[model samples]
Target: MTSEGTFCLVLHSHLPWLPHHGSWPVGEEWLYQAWAHSYLPVVELLRRFAGEGRRDVLTLGVTPVLAAQLDDPYSLRTFHEWLGHWQLRALHASTLWRGQPVLRELGAAEHRAALHATEDLETQWRHGFSPILRSLVDAATIELIGGPLTHPFQPLLDERIRAFALRSGLDDTGLRIGHRPAGIWAPECGYAPGMEDGYAAAGVERFLVDGPSLRGDTSAARTVGSSDVVCFGRDLEVTYRVWSPKAGYPGHANYRDFHTWAHEVGMKPSRVTGHQVAPPDKAPYEPALAADTLRLHVKDFVDTVVTRLRRLRARNGKEALVVAAYDTELFGHWWHEGPAWLDGILRALPEAGVRVTTLRGALEAGHLGPPVDLPASSWGSGKDWRVWDGEQVADMVEDNAALQRRLLAVRPGPLRDPVLDLAVNEAMLALSSDWAFMVTKDSAADYARRRARVHTERFGAVLRGERPLPLEDRVFGQLDARLL
Candidate 1:
């Protein structure tokens, strides 16, 4: 049977650099948790698909900052240790909470998962994530996407810094992955009108934008402005079916509740029994029930895509493109059953007469549409740049602008100064979009502010030669300060 239209699942995998940083509430702990729950499992699933000869299964964006950490020696050692600790914690949960049968079972499950993850890390991920990711790319199982250093909000970034960051980022990815990607998941999908020129200059063949940025007609990829660079807008109607803040399959009653945790065990043992159900009142999580719910949601999502594609074809008189982009951390991390659900969807889509492919694959399959001049937009609140540049974050926006100026002023001539490079690194870290987004959403706003301020202070101290450049802060070792 003929397929309806192409389905492109773009997963943006990113986390601000966190290796010498703090832990627990929000830091390396964030990285370790996501690494265990999401990255490890997601990559494993992709490897499984590749073993089955699946090619171009999805488009994956790995920010340069996160990639650096994944491949960093410190991160590799620490992550391994963290996995061991995870196993210990799970064992503690089982023994410490023996009185609670549900807790004991959950603890045992977690222990097994931790043990497997530790073994996987010791073997496949021993070197770092680069080798594993490169293997996937080499096998043509996934199309890798690259992004700027530190995941800065490009639309608000100074032109010189933005271009430098983009180029350096692409080069960094090439260094790690054996080739630079032609596509990128623009930081936060934040884009301004003329940014496509920068993308074109950097050799980026395609990028992603919010659905509203293209005026909601995301039937296919569109060339932006006069640049040959194509932009694929997320089909919110399709993407939101699986994940939206207010409602989504992840919030199903039978699924594990992300918020309800056993504080003593440091594990979540409750199901999302009800939306308003207090954490203490929520029912114990049952993996079997969650698996059943996952199967149902996977079927529903496939049906939704089929119906949407049929309607789009009828309206446009052609097989349209449906791009569902999401944070890679959503799988297994935010949604416990997400990895399994992903496996089911990938297997089911092809059987249901749906063509699953990467954005590059879709483009190659002739998914291009008319050119568009997109407005300043993002995949944030109101589909605008407010989340990163809102009133609540006005101070941060101003500080970022000042930091960019300082960085440009101190731009190295031809000589490579380690201090200057470190300064530039600090500046980029300060400009990360995560801090602003966290502040705006109040999701660890204090930590966000502290991190931003610390980076800014470090940038100043390095410039003034007030502090010695630490060997540990050596990320982007290939970064040439003259680029700024």
Candidate 2:
């Protein structure tokens, strides 16, 4: 049934700086996988919708670091090479697994996926992502959401540094996307009291927070504390319906199993046949079964949104707004069928009589309410800051706080020092909330700790007035030359 309320989908797209980082299990390979399986397919899907005249069907947060990587000349070259390697790996897999019918079929599917990604890259993404992404923003197919330069958790950052990060990030967005964004994803939806003022000063008119931030009263957009900037709380009820930390749609039995990777090529080759099934015992993936499952989940999600909005309108006696946010990488990167599902949902929502709007569009439509005081929060465990600051990551917290103080104290001269500029860049990367999150979750904990240390040590060296490390000098010199 039709409802007067609106539903907004916010896709928060972000990845840490990975150009010079390691590859394989993590690093540049991570970037390539997301680019091929997630970004390419997702953007192409959005383009298809735009062809049919869809506008603002969803909101997208493409963090500045991610944007830089997509636009970088070095990244473009390496990504092309990575795509070639992917196809080669698939070809080898198809040949090597010939005796095993199921494995051979899996290899063939991966080969087709690789070829498709290569073709998309050549036709649409050959030049760079800036122009294509800008076109979408121009067409209003999506509203761009900017965030801090390196996805720093603004809540814990020093006030001035936080402001600089936000302002610099917005400026970068303007440079790359042809306009400054009016909204931001706020780096993990992490919020501290009075951050509304920081966002306001940076000219960001709106942001998102966890539903608990608004005390779960997300019936309408809200102005926080004393600031006029609007805040939209992510409705956990709707978001978790698709994917949550512990469980969600991607775990459906018919979907591709992410954990059962092929030893030779590291490609996933099995379906999530059952929760208790061993990787070796899991059934082979079947596209037909997955297609059927996708339809069911899509309908279930659309129906859920309709029912929730209808109930919310009835309870409020007014038009209500619901925002469902997620990481953009989840689509093809983690869930093999994610892009198709997204394409289906975007088309079905409007047909089902549900209104699709960007968070900015919602506010402009006047779906707003009085100011509310928000509690310090994040879209993390316990709906608070524990994941980034709890016992597991206490050392990281101390190191980040120390580095922020040191970096802020040493302002760069008007004439840029390549050393200082590079140091500042590293410091920003070090402060990324991803490190602490990985540590807390025990996922890639060692890599996370090492990355945190390397950046901080580089930042510390520069702060101590020491010369840039040898490797730093060579790397930053090349980057400096490119800027000129």
- Per-model clash counts, in order, read 0, 0
Candidate with best lDDT: 1
**Model 1, range 1-484, lDDT digits (tens) per residue?**
9988889999999999888889888999999989999999999999999999999999999999999988999888989998888888899999987998876888999999999999999899999989999999999999999999889999898899899989999999999989899999999999988999999999999999989998889989999999899999999999999987678999999999998878776889899999989998999898989988888998999999999999999999999889999999999999999999999999999999999999989988999998999999999989999999899999999999998888888848688888888899889889999999999999999999999999999999999999997878778898878777
The Cα RMSD of model 1 versus the native structure comes to 1.1
Give the Å error, residue 216, model 2: 1.5
State TM-scores per candidate.
0.98, 0.94
The predictions' CA RMSDs to the true structure, in order, are: 1.1, 2.9
lDDT, model 2: 0.85
Which stretches in model 1 have alpha-carbon errors above 4 Å?
Answer: 97-100
**Candidate 2 per-residue C-alpha lDDT over 402-421 given as tens digits, one digit per residue, 9 for 90 to 100:** 88888767755667576766
C-alpha lDDT of all candidate models, in order: 0.92, 0.85
